[model samples]
Target: MRSRPELHGTNGAVSSTHWLASAAGAAAFDRGGNAFDAAATAAFVIQVVEPHLNGPAGDTPIMVYDAAAEEVKVVCGQGPMPSAATVGAFRERGLAEVPASGLLPACVPGAFGAWLRVVGRYGRLPIADVLAPAIRYAEDGYPLLPNASRMISALAPLFRDEWTESGATYLNGGRAPKPGARVRNPILARTFQRILDEAKARTSNREAQAEAAIDIFYEGFVAEAIDDFMATAKPLDSTGSRNAGLLTGADMAAWRPVVEDPVVVGYRGLLVHKPGPWSQGPVFLQQLALLEGFDLKEFGFGSADHLHTVVECAKLAFADREAWYGDPNHADVPIAALLDPEYSAARRALISGAPSSILRPGSPGGRVPWVPSFAPSSTATDGPDWLAELGEGIPAIMRLTASTGDTTCISATDREGNMVVATPSGGWLKSSPVVPGLGFPLGTRGQMALLAEGHNNVLAPGKRPRTTLSPTLVCTDDGRPYLAFGTPGGDQQDQWTLNFFLNHVDFGMSPQQAIEAATFHSEHVPTSFSPRQSFPLGVSVEDGIPETAIAELRRRGHQVRVTPAMSLGKVCATGARSDGGVFAAASPRGEQAYGVAR
Candidate 1:
């Protein structure tokens, strides 16, 4: 039984990690906008209300099914490393790993440009309509979330002592404000207003306005602020030392959001689409390819046999991620060979009745595999309980103090068969110091890069990091738009969504049921975050899972970490129904997540 009923509508549907953001999307639909416009609008609003989880300077990978083009496109909103960001530069600094939350690992901010581009290219409404909600929330005020408050409170000492700009933007007289207090960022509001003013001055056309807006952010005042801030700001990071960032105004002007085709795999008649190798998305497809061999429905939903098979497959797929997945523009990722049926079959042979402790990424196409190992991450005993829940977006682990990273999700669908889903993350309040005047932080995605030279994901000038911000889009057997869904868990994104997809397709569960159902994931492979912690033979499960399965998992040598019920995932989904209607559903795990349709 689902805790909340799935919302159905003949007009449009919206589901997001936050209720306010979903409501903002619904408002966009009421304004005669399509799914892309609704989604972009919601994302901007998300940047305002969920500041602890995401900021405007973060990354956003969007999956859009445009009814006009009759094609699905993946928007690469992840920014590349700065021109000065090189392995040699990092090594010269005497750093083995990129600092977690500082300017040193900074990259160009990508969310504004990506959102504007998606809406400008396929949306019906004007750019101003898409940005108004976010601007209003920033200018006026919105109720602070408990999570955001906790993040601020936990980092209060750091903010007061070092990240004073962050303290100015988020704190009340150098102290973290209470949850539910009215929070305002007039500077952020003014920043967008300036962009809007400049864009309107340049163009009267809606589409041109979008392009003009993008230019303003990347090449105009916003970029100038970022450059100025990074030019002199020395702030504390995961290294426990203050460092300047590498990102410059030139890097901002040089980078642009690219629209590309998504990597896809067929699963039980549905075409499952995920972002390219630049993201950890194809790992989800790899899992799908392997699971196609198993009769999961016959294994029964949430059964010990089912969970074991999924976890084992996750280990194999993620092992490949750690060894191979990277920006294809910089390196050759054997994605095609990795997804081949023969390769999947050969890898499937590795799964047994018992949990496997070995990390195994298959040698696809006779290529050698190499996985990096790292020291354990530092955790503060006094940190908030939500630390692990914060998806490992921007990584930098601190042993002596505290550091964290997180992200959020947005999804929308309309009656016209337009669908869009995006995972906007990075630049969390705890990720980096707030850029002065911009009221946000530069993303530390470069931290995901490895110090190991010649590695697929090694730090390099102008190369995109292998991001975990992946969103999934699905199509019917006939190639028509079906569904869009994603969550805000770093390494767990593919694992959690893979389980949810199986719950929907294989076990015949409804969308709401699939999201609310018990979830499990294996952290057996090395994490993408700093310190690169790995848990060999480990599987984390919701307490909602059958105790029998837990005991069985232990019996099979699986070290299970049982978490509180309804605490694993925060997935949101919007999909098309066969009867020409649309549906939306949000995970009950995040009380703020909501689904609305009209």
Candidate 2:
């Protein structure tokens, strides 16, 4: 059962991982803001509330559908490797892969720049208007959710012992705030205020003002603070050692988010859109391609047969993602051939009755199939079964991040027919020290890059690390924008999204039903994070998938891990209809996610 009712609005609808952030988007729409305005507002609010999951120092890849232009464009908010970040630099440290958390994995902060682009180009409101909610939340204080409080508490020991700046930022009086307790971040508030103040000075045009704010972040005080901190400090990283970051002011100044066409695929009757190879987004389309030939609805949604077929397809697609997906600008990505109908049919032919316990990335268009060098000895898992002691009903937001890792998502659609779905992630508080006086930390996205030579994702200056932050947009059969959806799980983002999309498209479920349904995903391919492990034929199913189904899956030579019904995915979605109605839904698995409309 869904915890809350689906919100229907004729004018607009918004959904996000945090209730207040949803309200912020709704409030923007109430002020006559367009979808971009509403989404930008909510995105900032998420940074303040879901600090453990994302921050201003994080990255966001956004999908925007402009009703006037009748086109969908992607804002590539992911930052690139610093100019000083070279494979040789990492090799000098004797590291096989970038450390999961620290300066070593830091990238140019992109969240602020991405938000600026959204408001300046597509939004009806000024940059200051879009950021008001976040500023108020930061300065006046907001009730901290249990998920945020718990994340802080869990990492409090590390902060206290090593990363004191983070401890000072997250803890109050050196203690994690209780759930629902009022919390404030005066420093973060000042940071936003400073940007707004700079933007206000460039009163010539709204776009100019927004660009001024971006300059302040990338070229002004913000950049200075970050450079100064990294130059002087040697903070503890995931390797249990101190390392200074290689990112410099030049990297920040040289970086700017760009707009690009989304990677597109025709799946069944819908036209699916995703970010390019810089993210794992294309894997969703690849999975769809592999599953298209199957009689999906005949097996019935949630059935063991349906589950097995989809899970198997996921493994095949993710294996390809591991082998071939990377920064298309930096690497020669054979995406066109990978998405070809003939190629998908060939990949589909590989699926059989019993599960294949191996990573099998097919040769696309006769090119050699790419594979990583380091193979994990054990099955890969993305969970913190040990954290169950945190108590019952701890929001899946924390578990989603702690278990598999986390990010934050926002979906919005306005009466004007414009839509935006953005997945903003990276720079978790646990990743590194909070920049002094900046109230946020740099992103650890560098961890996604491989250290091995000859690999496409190997560390290189100005190249984007292949990120797991994938947002999705889909169009109706007739080519009109239909739905925008995404989730927060690292590798599982595409898997959970595919599951939810199939529920709605194939099973005829409503937006809320699609999100509320139990979800599952496969870990059969390599994960994006360090150690880059794969689990031959591993599948994780939520508890609601019947015991008989689990038994059948195991019988099919699958290693099945069972989780609580709602513990698998933290997803939020918004849908638009030709009838001028908008629908919004958020996963109730974690009470943090909410859908709001009026």
Candidate 3:
């Protein structure tokens, strides 16, 4: 039996990475808002409650399935580098790779635009109404989470010495607030209120008002403050050197979020949808394609055989990610050929009973993949600079302590069948100096771009960084939406989501059961953050996995590390049921994620 009863409802349902955010979404449903409205409401609340993980200035890539249109679409909220951001500039700065923490890695913020896009086109409530929960929480205060408090305290020294604005904003009496202590962000509340005020002054039309709010973020005082701070400030970075940022007011005005068709692939009679090449989402499709060749049921769930097969496949898929994935607008992505049935069969042949430690990127469509040269950040004897090694950046340090990396997810399903999945991340508070008076930080998404010449993901002017923020939607053969799910683990996002999906579809687990299932992830490929490192044959499995399985993995050339049970994944999901009831589930790992339905 599933450990928890599935959350059932007909009116609506919302699952988010934070309990308060979930409650905010349920409040939207109570106000007669649709899934789109509820998701937007919860997204804003996440920024308020999980400030260390996400903020108003972060990037969010959303996947939405419109019941009316019977179609799934992606909102490309992943931001691009500024026109002045170039490889030459970094070279002049005497940097080998992008610094994990600094303004130099900042990109145009995209979450606000992505959220506005969804609510404007598919929502039933006013912009003001949808944002009310977040505003209230920010102004009135909410109890602090242990994770947030811990992250603040860990970076307290850096904030105090280098980014005073961040210290003043996150610290209470020059120290991190104790867990459960009430925390308020009056300035952040004012920042959000200013957008609503501008929108109300523009017009009474709901869509128009949403557009007005978007304009204020991109072209009004919000943009001005970001530009002023970036133009003058040179805050301490990963290299312990103060550096200026590249983003300008013109970049914000010039950029706009676009609606693109999701990349669709078939697996086990279900059609899966993921974001385009701009995100690491398509890797999930690649993994599924490889696994399709294997009879997973024969190996069985939680078995040593199953663990080895999946880890080996992940290494191959992620190896290709480091070589070929990038912004399709700038790079030639061979999606059609990469997902070809024949190509998948050829790749599947490489998987064996034992694990392979080396990076193995496949050539698709006769196009050679560009593998990065082995270049470590510092002249250290260690193999690669893992997240723990990069202790200077806030994101790396936070992930090292929390186990779950930076980011947050929100999923909602309304009575009308509309479903939305949004993953908001980037612009981590530790990555850049907080914009003065704005009460939020700017995104350092540009750090994901490679510095190698001629590589598809090379850092360049006006190019979107290949981000790790991925949201997924699954549908049946008849094109009916089945599930909307996602999580917040940087490189592990796709891996965790993939495991959760397989648990539900292949193993016949309920939504809650799938999220609670023993989880494992491979870190065999190069990481997405600064000081990028690769573990030739590394696998991290939860303690729940059988000891025999762990021992077998070790004997098979895999470096296995067991973590605490329920400490691996933070997935949140909402799906449509055959009985006309909606179901939602959230990970119980961090005690922050929750799902509510009624």
Q: What is the TM-score of each predicted model, taking all chains together?
A: 0.96, 0.95, 0.97
Encode model 1's per-residue lDDT on 253-280: one tens digit a residue.
9988999999999999999999999899
List the lowest-lDDT window of 10 residues for candidate 2.
386-395
lDDT (C-alpha, whole model) for all candidates: 0.85, 0.84, 0.86
Q: Kindly report the root-mean-square deviation of model 3 from the true structure over all alpha carbons.
A: 2.4
Per-residue lDDT tens digits of candidate 3, residues 115-173? Answer: 99889998989999988889999999999988778777877776776688988888988
Clash counts for the predictions, in order: 2, 2, 1
Write down the RMSD of all candidates, one decimal each.
3.0, 3.6, 2.4
Q: After best superposition, candidate 3 residue 159: deviation in angstroms?
A: 2.4
Better candidate number, 2 or 3, judged by TM-score:
3
Error of 1 at 326 (Å): 0.3
The candidate that achieves the highest TM-score relative to the unseen native structure: 3
What's the TM for model 3? 0.97
Q: Which candidate leads the pack in lDDT?
A: 3
Worst ten in a row by lDDT for model 1: 396-405
Candidate 1 runs further than 4 Å off = 375-405
TM for candidate 1 is: 0.96
